[model samples]
Target: MGREFIAYIPGQKDINGQFTKANLGRTLGLLKKLLKGGLYEFGTLTAAYNGWAKGSPEYDQWMAEVAVYPTTAQNVIRDAVVNALTHVKGSNDDPIPLTIVWEGGPEGVTSRYEAAGPSWTVTITGYPPPAKSMLAERRDKKPS
Candidate 1:
């Protein structure tokens, strides 16, 4: 099977900003909100939109027929988001993909994800989670 691009689930979906999940940025519309919006947690929004090259529906479907690689996921998201943000703000600040990670400690603690670029590898190291769930939250724009 192929690895597909998807959002990293940080916590929950309805828990306000506490919960996090991966968002599929298949369109410029989604990128606008991510850039103008405040990123939850450390780099939730940043990583969520670092590359903005998340594959399109047609491309993704074709890849599924062949294979998928989340590594490429970040690229798609980053490109799209950056373009959207640039068009919106008329500025530039390239960030990496949203690696919504949760590190568990004995005393009810969790660590933020790394800010390294696409080249660096992220690994969760620490105490086992008593109960944890990181999820991505991507939604289509509301009809206007």
Candidate 2:
């Protein structure tokens, strides 16, 4: 089974201080460019819009699914996220928040700008759940 992770990247704003689709695209593009040659593979990229109906929200975000080897370490994932954020933010002072959630569990990393510079928090409290067995599922199902 392939281990897939999701990257949630906040959208950037334009000169007018507004979150435009163009800016969001640019942000995703930059992230993709920076994440190249990493220890993982890119899946698909999508946009997530958080509006009033969804609750209190500021702007939309981009979601990218990344597939990594089962043996990949948490540090490797954290480094990829940090590198992407560093390149995307560039000289911009605004803080860019990026999060990567591993499949099967809550293990993940959250990257953000701090007073000392870029920083990331890793959470690996538990191991990922084992993959479901097809035979087990078949046995549980009743024959028609």
Candidate 3:
């Protein structure tokens, strides 16, 4: 069976330090692509796929709601991602920093993962993405 999970991408701020419509749109678009692919990996971990909650009205509702209000939608998404991550044997350890990418522009956010009952969820808190050096260190050094 495919594992189910939700990924929350925070809206990037504009020049006035506000989350404008464009930022929200980009975040939503990224989320949509993530959901459609249904798979991801962190660091050296093998690939993992998202699971389906199967006949869950709340799950269905939450999925529908995420695109409209990113902030309010975090809790629901966190539940799903946590549930899915639980199925994996190991954790990413440094989930937030590790997930951030430093290519082109900044995809800034701190990811918070939580697991409860049969749900897995992740929340993306707005922050700067990792610096190039930090990412390089993460890639070069072994976990201690």
Per-residue accuracy of model 2 over 1-144 as CA lDDT, tens digit each: 121111112222211121233344454454454355652232222222221121212212111112332335545544544354444455663323443333445544433434453434333333442223223343456586
> Which predicted model would earn the best TM-score?
1
Whole-model lDDT, model 1: 0.32
- What's every prediction's RMSD, in angstroms? 15.8, 15.5, 18.6
Error of 3 at 71 (Å): 14
lDDT of each: 0.32, 0.33, 0.30
Q: Each model's TM-score?
A: 0.23, 0.21, 0.19
Candidate 3 lDDT over residue span 3-44, tens digit each: 222222121211111112223333323333444345321210
Position 9, candidate 2: lDDT: 25
Q: Candidate 3: list runs displaced more than 4 Å.
A: 1-52, 68-108, 112-144
Better of 1 and 2 by lDDT: 2
**TM-score, predicted candidate 3 vs. hidden true structure:** 0.19
Candidate achieving higher TM-score, 1 or 2:
1
* Regions of model 1 farther than 4 Å from truth: 1-28, 34-95, 106-144
